[model samples]
Target: MAAEISSDLLARFAAIVGAKYAISDINDQQPYLKEWRDRYHGRTPLVLLPGSVEEVSAILKLADETGTSIVPQGGNTGLVGGQVPHATGNELLVSLKRLDKVRAADPDSNTLDVEAGVTLQRVQEAADGVGRFFPLSLPSEGSCTIGGNIGTNAGGTGVIAYGNTRDLILGLEVVLPGGRIWHGMRHLRKDNTGYDLRNLFIGAEGTLGIVTAAVVKIFPKPRSVGTAFIGVDSPADALNLLHEARANGGGTVTAFELMPRLGIDFVVRHVSDARDPIAEKYPWYVLLEVSTQSEEGVGDALEGMLMAAYEKGYAGDAVIASSLEQAADFWRLREQLSETQKFEGGSIKHDVSVPIRLVPAFLDKAIAAVEAFIPGCRPLPFGHLGDGNIHFNVSQPVGGDKKEFLAKWEATNEVVHAIVAEFHGSISAEHGIGQAKRALLPGVKDPVEMEMMRAIKATLDPKGIMNPGKVL
Candidate 1:
């Protein structure tokens, strides 16, 4: 049970954080109480903006003593409503935006110790300043924080090379529910000391504890990057191109993204300054990237791969980016796809992943199922093909009522997820199971695995005071 906040408890919280940092007025707390996607809007008794880890610990300690629930929020750009609090207005919203800092960076060790509140874009800039690269690239990197990325184990275009946020983390600094801080900020390449605790909190979604800081791995900056926008006959051909690129590109393949013709048309029509690169449209398109340490012969290698693909009828048309501006332009077309789809009215989106070889079958079956539900519903299937994760999204039919279309969210999700289950794929790929997917967890998770997760939750959060009613 959640405890009600009294005037006395609010006064104590205000004393820990300054009076200005502690907000209780509904108007003052409006921004922090809502989520980025506008899907979750809640009421909170108090919003606490702690400036330091010590302040966070003190606040958590006070909340623990008072039996008050605490909800941790970072950047507030999460898609699944994980960073928002419940609607009951009983939990205390703890915003870590003030704790943004880069504690240290050692290029020799290829690691950087950064605070959780640091934005993903800022981390990338910091790494670039030190002549290194932080390869966690997401569409919302400008607004999403390192804490939320680590919490969700976010994957983006770089996953084909650098892996997910969990893979990039070498150590962490977390504050547990009882207000005790765990300082495990080591940058060792190999530390075989018992079980790995750092991996535990990477995708926990702030259920077990709050991530205060982290020591993340970095890589040497690539001297050259080759980008291409290719038109493929189908998703199967895109996969074939990916395999060929890996074999002939000599380990330089970094990203392989798939986009359907409808998705590209949406971006070109809705997104500003977006245009099609190819003279003619194809059923499916692929944006492939290769990064190398040597500047010479990288473009030649990419061209050679595409030429071979064309000879085998795998590629219909292709365009290799010749300059840095051209490369950015090619990526811009891919990155703006999600935003462009918003103008098409209500949409049902599923972020799922399957085995690499099963992607074609998954796409074929998912689209067929969706069409069976509502014909001509404009299926916009696109995402990281190399990782077998696709952002399978459905836009409302042209001239359809948005409310009536969105009313079938549950039905649409069932149709898509059933196909995903048939292929033995995950319903939630990079996004964590926040409040949005809490109800669906039991349906997909095995009975024994669900019990084990509950056991861990009970052990770490005995009082159930951390992010109540989220993820399990």
Candidate 2:
């Protein structure tokens, strides 16, 4: 809504954060303009790196006064183009990487306060250094930032036991629209005052406010661990094994992952260090883990459950890791599945979730639906079976044209999402509805829910400056 950015506006932005931190050159902004998946390439005129909250306030004040749009970015590792600017090339990009710092860590209270720019892996290392555990582990933890994770409400492998990024957060410090900072960073577990603003911004995908820092809950590190790689007869068998393991371990099953046999084959064929934990081939495989505070019988519990499942004909074969290195080797097969898919030509991806009891039915119906829609299409469905979140991806037919297959992205998406809708499942489970899923929101969300969200967004960001064209 504002006019083209003038020299005065650029100079003021530079004055707030020193000139060295403000960049306007077109060539220098390429790194910040693109996203991780290369799905969205936005265009912007300037990139600003503010070192402190005060500088961020100053920049927002100026931007609001001039009606210039602002796009906040962190690590540039988002998959849904939530942190990138729009294609208009008019908004300014604000990077929070300079605000990387641990404000405080209270081990007694089991809380750690950190700035938004801190890398997730760094926060995990800090928690480990203090003999505590932060259980938000993701594939992009090495390069992703806490702000981006909170913005997306990221759900990683540990979500089966712990929770999503929103559940781990105790409080947040956000800079609101028009340069007002909300100091709501409390470590208390119960705060039922009025409206919970923190929850609104947690999964808003940066469309409400700019999150500066947060106070996150931590837990005592596990003392004993167990990991197992099992070959299952089918998805139904895998779900049955999950219930059996949870029952046998006294609800201590920390992680349970399901993958198609083809995913394991792809990983073994592509990744050098990733070899199949189980030599036998089945239609489906499961990688499970259980941890306990006491170091008495972690491995025994896993083996006993597997044996019971084998006796019942649910499990075909199993391999329990004997050492820490062996456990890691077992997990390598699951974690490397996504990266190995790159060797395949073109892959259409979907992150959907259903009730744990209905996961088998949903997968069966969706896979059959996609195959019927396009014959010979390869479907690789894998993810956290315990939580019912599956990464249902489809590869092009063997020796098919990559571009031609990719051109049917919408058709393929419809075939899969129709089955999801029929089963009352969500189209996006872990990855949020950023720019990628904005247009499809109305089709999935109820009218009443969409109205409530729109009301909240209008109340918080009336001018529509905070991350336009995303989420809502």
Predicted candidate 1, C-alpha RMSD: 1.0
Off by over 4 Å in 1: none
* lDDT score, candidate 1: 0.90
User: What ranges in model 2 sit over 4 Å off?
Assistant: none
Q: Across residues 1-472, which tens digit of lDDT does each residue of candidate 1 receive?
A: 5767898888999899999999889998888877756789988888999999899899888877888898999888888888899888888999988889999999999999999999999999999999999999998899889998998999999898889998999999999888999999989999999989898788888988899999999899999889999999999999899999998864478999999999899989987788899998899999999989996888899889899999998887899998989989889989988888889898888899999899999999999889889776988989999999999999999999989988988899999999898899998998889988899999999999999889988998898888888889
TM-score of each: 0.98, 0.98
TM-score, cand. 1 vs. native: 0.98
C-alpha lDDT of all candidate models, in order = 0.90, 0.88
What digit string (tens of lDDT, one per residue) describes model 2 on residues 244-290?
A: 99889533788999999989889989988787777778999989889
Clashing pairs in 2: none
